[model samples]
Target: MSIPENARKYWRANLKYLAVLLLIWFAVSFGCGILFKDFLNRYSLGGFKLGFWFAQQGSIYVFVMLIFVYVWLMNRLDKKYGCNEPNSRKK
Candidate 1:
């Protein structure tokens, strides 16, 4: 069977969001934590080295936040595409 054009659009949008989020994740988790650690260490966050905090805690927090963001975005997208659950809660 052939996929509908709307389905293809939905998937394209989904992939765009996923790629952006993953890029953010990678930047925070690896860029600040390793590649730019020296530059980031020049600052402080709650008295902890910025780079260290990002490596140990900040990235984790960002990831959790991103999960929520994805949920919210996808929910909106589902609604826009008429694919949302009828009984689901709205944002």
Candidate 2:
């Protein structure tokens, strides 16, 4: 049996969300942590060099935040596509 069109659309939307979120993570984790490190070093964050902070701490923080963001987006997506768990909590 083949997948339904609504399922296909839902999957496509999910992938789009993943791609955007991952792209943002990569830009922060790699771009800020490495490529822009020199430029970022010109500033300070809590007495730490901005680039070093991003490389060592900021990326991790952003990744955690992204986890929550992904969950929130997926929740909305699930609701939109009528695919959410029947007992799932809403906020």
Candidate 3:
């Protein structure tokens, strides 16, 4: 079955956003925490090693932020694309 043009557009935009976000997530979580850990550890934030914090807590926080951002962004996209459902008003 062929996909609708509107759906294809939305899917393409979503895929683009997902790819960029995943790249950033990987860079921060694995690249900085594992690959460049030693250099990053030289900088401390509060009593935590920078790389350690990123590997442990920081990445989790970023993941949470990404969830919220994705939801907000997708909602906006839905409205923009006229894909949002109409609100029901109770009389």
lDDT per residue (tens digit) for residues 18-79 in model 3: 88788888888898789988988999888998989888887888888888888887888878
Candidate 2: the clashing residue pairs are none
| Model 3 superposed RMSD (Cα) | 4.1
Alpha carbon lDDT of each predicted model: 0.94, 0.94, 0.82
Better of 1 and 2 by TM-score: 2
TM-score of each: 0.91, 0.92, 0.85
- So what's the TM-score on candidate 1? 0.91
**Pairs in clash, predicted candidate 1:** none
Q: Which residue pairs does candidate 3 place in steric collision?
A: none
| Model 3 spans with C-alpha error above 4 angstroms | 86-91
Q: Please provide, for model 2 over 20-82, each residue's C-alpha lDDT reduced to its tens digit, 9 standing for 90 to 100.
A: 999999999999999999999999999999999999999999999999999999999999988
User: Which segments of model 2 are wrong by more than 4 Å?
Assistant: 86-91
